[model samples]
Target chain A: MSRVGIRELAAELGMSISTVSRAMNARSDVSAATRERVTAAAERLGYRPNQSGRTLRRGATGTVALVIQTNTARTEMGETFYFNLCDGLQQTLATRSLDLVVLPVGASADRDRFLVNAVDRHLADAYIVSNTDRTDRRIEYLTQRAVPFVTLGRGGAADHAWLDLDFEGVAAHSVARLAGLGHERIALASDDRDINSTWEYACGYRRALAEHELPADGGWEIRVPDTPEGGTVLADRLLDMSPRPTAVVLAQETLAIGLYRRLREAGVEPGRDLAVVGFRKNPVCDYLVPSLTSFEVSLVDYGRRLGEIVIGLLTASPDDEPVHEVWEMTVVPGESDAHPPCEKAAG
Target chain B: MSRVGIRELAAELGMSISTVSRAMNARSDVSAATRERVTAAAERLGYRPNQSGRTLRRGATGTVALVIQTNTARTEMGETFYFNLCDGLQQTLATRSLDLVVLPVGASADRDRFLVNAVDRHLADAYIVSNTDRTDRRIEYLTQRAVPFVTLGRGGAADHAWLDLDFEGVAAHSVARLAGLGHERIALASDDRDINSTWEYACGYRRALAEHELPADGGWEIRVPDTPEGGTVLADRLLDMSPRPTAVVLAQETLAIGLYRRLREAGVEPGRDLAVVGFRKNPVCDYLVPSLTSFEVSLVDYGRRLGEIVIGLLTASPDDEPVHEVWEMTVVPGESDAHPPCEKAAG
Candidate 1:
């Protein structure tokens, strides 16, 4: 955008090009007074180095590759969450002239050959991992190559730079909200993506039970695929329980939606027969006979934070501390959870 | 993905490389029979022209850039319709081995420069328009240069391939649906960005009303921005009408959401006091106090169709006829529409 070079800036300021270059690169040889003069001249001239040449000279391209795995069925790739995060990421990266390469990163075919061939081959400065599991080959390869990278959710360990939603708080809040309505029996339709998000949220549910001094029932956890069909299957299985869950806290909206359809087919009223809550208050949830109560995460903000981290990683020295960002979730209460166990409520 | 060469195929088929090359290029000297034989062998051997040499030779890369405009306030980029359209576009183009260069075409500094300048400099073969309007300069400049282009939606009278949604069908359906529910008086909320869609739909609405023997009333069309606050303003204006509309159809989900909120605050239930329907259903719409009924369009399919057209144009002769495509919209019924007025049912 700035179409001016350092030589033009130096010429305008009556300063030697070498002195200006050193100031721009932050060299110690130039005195502070001269550095200020050089900086001001560069700023006034609106100088921007040729991006391609600068990136080539430097070791990285200052661009990050967002590798969304589309090999196996991925929850993030197929859902609204993926787009919102990318949208948020664009908001953050577009400002810094950084571009996101949205390529299917899975090695399902020759794409895998491209990913493992070389990080430098892709000309990316850093890698951003999404929809990957605890032992993903892509993350393992990136770490081995010593390339800067960030993950949306935890990838194996907490050592890498990441920004994750508060999975625990969501479970805790659901429990509190349901208990306040005098509901004793609660169940969870946990997401089956990476064990990380599901495990964390399940762990949080246990923690909340301990904090509230409530019993942790074995009937609560149902590990199901992160699709509406999977939720329907889980719902069928739950109905076989000695005392079916009075309230359900499904980890994703697709599950909640599937549950609604299955329940309707079974001639059951949602708000009256069962109370439900889920993550990702998906927009379609409210259109169900009884809407779902769920938590809303800002994917745009998440992507923006990821962008900031990538930009920071791109411009900062290799030794600069990695940036870590964490955003919480907001609860969106819907009609599905508006009823109590004793009597269904009407507004 | 095949990465096989024509020369390699020629060697395997025991044919002269020059003859094979001539056949592949469709040279007039090569007989039709020979050309068919050569093409069959090439397909069998999975021979694709070397992209590097082709890119250098024609000054055109077999890549179409999709420039999506990102505004600060527009965060619902993950809307279901966009994903579906993009998916559709990708699916159609994948067969041709053409790549879609996805980038956020936003304003840098105060000036909005189309990244067309970036693509025009031998970066891509064509430009695929996404989320562009009638006053777009991209259409004008690209047309002057005679570049192969396609649009998801039309902008003015540009000579390019395009695939647009049937807004007229959407409008007709909304009216017919309301009429089936016995709604006589109605109002409409139209989004500013979706003028073309609004225009077609409005005409359809009028046509449908005339067919139903319902008279059009003045002060029934409410202009609104695509936001919750805009919905609020439109709702206020519509509610204050001398003979208030029993139903409303909106061009945007945010506006419909605002209307639902406004009605709730004024102690009016959505289905009881005002029936509502919207286009461009956002993720948060289902959770709105009354889930919105609306039209659904697939953005992924739209993107895919545009991609396919670009590939077709690029691979064909220079005088190839531009391809025209239009995707249909289906109704997504929610809780907004009520049967025979909720007050009458209550009585």
Candidate 2:
């Protein structure tokens, strides 16, 4: 049997298409009795209004496209982050009868062009762009187009709405804790990407060092891929240093796992030989012997706020102010960062 | 400045809307010269045909929806699986200029209703439903509707296209390996969900035990959540067993991580005290003290095949044979599954 459509339903009801549509849509103009009648008839007939028709008429797709970068090396920790964030976003959007569509831009694809085409084609009513760069062209284009959009992280364009993690706070707190423990030399590790969070984290590290009266050494700043292998390389880099740093702060949690294993293989204990601090309390981190000390954030709550902000922007009047907020992360102290400092750094 | 649309481009080029569209779509009816002129003008004017209008005219969305189940207990291994699969699917879809949209159904929502609504709305040209149940109503609906669709795993509907992992094979191999290692008592562990894979795994386990001439103990078949905490619970359950199994096969890698940690805490070494086998070679599993012996699959390749199958279904004639294939996973040997049956009765 062919699928029943609105036209067939209207024909069967002996009513005009406009009345049937209005009744089905529950418009204010339609009477309560007529709406009930149309709804029951529609359900009985198994009729469904085509999404394309509704979208064209309403000038909205009622979908939000979240752009995530696709890389072959995405760690489980990375997946955890995206999954939790998406869960929160999805739950919040569910309240408004809006669907969330995750669009991944392949590493080889042009992300800016993809976003532009997605906007031009009206693929979604709004967009949430993740992995934002410090000087992101996508943000500039979205702002100029005046599109209803929210970024997962801050970009150079401050006028537009964005929600950024408190990476600076995480760094400052980690550094302060380590410095108070009599660690004069502290290193910082972050992904090689020139994203806003990495920049903010590095700045936090520098400022924290200044406050602690510790000299900033260029050798201490490390940029590597956010993979397990990257962690191993980080360990090597630290070991190769003339006088290794007693403590290190990781911008991502996966790196800490790798670093711990490699350090142990080299007879360097994580907590005893080198103080370590990770960025998130990931599930795998639970398996770490001396549980990793990391910053924790309610990703679902953050995703909810992001959803609320985007929905507010979408429905609000043109004169309403754009929201720019920072999501704060609390430190979850563990055995990894409890030690004062390593007496002998390299094994 | 306002964005340029197809109408504006048509007016600027002195061509009918249909002619412009035909040329843009590279329809054979339009002249090559006209196509070139229309394409050049469109590029110059920055014109983009609205997706909704095109979707309505073509009766296809030029998008493929991949439905992934959402749960709060999703482990990192789950993420890895989805991420890699999506990457492969997306790459394959890109070849046909089709977009891949991931639609996650929340744990609390009705999955069947969700799939039905998506189909009714004409959300995409094709659908790829993951986490299929043993008796899935969604499969029946899709098959009856004759919609272009493929499942990530087998459902009750045999006529439809599906690609399932070789869970039965894994179970058989793991059991055989343990039985060959002089182990009479062996256990099988799987997620608590009544999905097709879990059912298949259990069937394989039973068949393998029968072949080995071992008594099938109802107490040995353990079902739990697929999280690390689930693994901890699994460890306690094993410890409490009257005569604990000397060897165990885990259907998910995350469980192995938890089980290992808990077992070690009880002074029960994983590979030594109990011969353990895991399902996947997940990144975190690499951090296991004794490496995990698990199955390895090229998820990207698997995803690519799924994408190809769906695309073929979408474009092929109605009478074409539907594909139903099983994906094979190779075993990667590690230290965790190398030991024979333990000598001691209890720790």
| TM, every model | 0.66, 0.81
Can you give the lDDT of residue B61 in candidate 2?
75
State the lDDT of candidate 1 residue by residue for A1-347, as single tens digits.
Answer: 43455446767878754456556656565689888988777667766432322332223444556765443323222344555567667656666655555644322235444456436444356777776466666666777877777877775666767767777778889888888887777787787666577777887788877777766787678878875578688778666666677777876666776677677677666777888888776644544656678887655555666776666556555444554444566798888889787333211
Alpha-carbon deviation at B60 in model 2, angstroms: 2.9
In model 2 chain B, where is the ten-residue run with the lowest total lDDT?
Answer: B49-58
- Candidate 1, residues B37-60, lDDT tens digits: the string is 989987787765422223221234
Cα lDDT for residue A190, model 2? 90
What is the iRMSD in Å for candidate 2?
2.6
Candidate 2: residue B215 Cα off by (Å): 2.8
Per-residue accuracy of model 2 over A1-347 as CA lDDT, tens digit each: 44455557778988755467557656575699999989999889876543221222123677888898867465334367776777777877776777888887765679999899788867788889988888999998988897788888888657888878888888988999999999888999999988888998988899999999987898899988888889999998987886789999998777887798788888889988899988777765666768899987766666766776666666655565676777667789999878888766642
Specify the CAPRI tier of model 1.
Answer: incorrect
Docking class of 2: acceptable
Question: Once superposed on the true structure, which residue ranges of model 2 sit more than 4 Å away at CA?
Answer: A1-58, A76-78, A345-347, B1-58, B76-78, B345-347
How high a TM-score does candidate 1 get?
0.66
DockQ of 2: 0.23
lDDT for each residue of candidate 2 in B65-184, tens digit (9 for 90 to 100): 999876646534336778777777887777767888888776567889888878877777788988888888998898789788898888765788887888898899888988988888
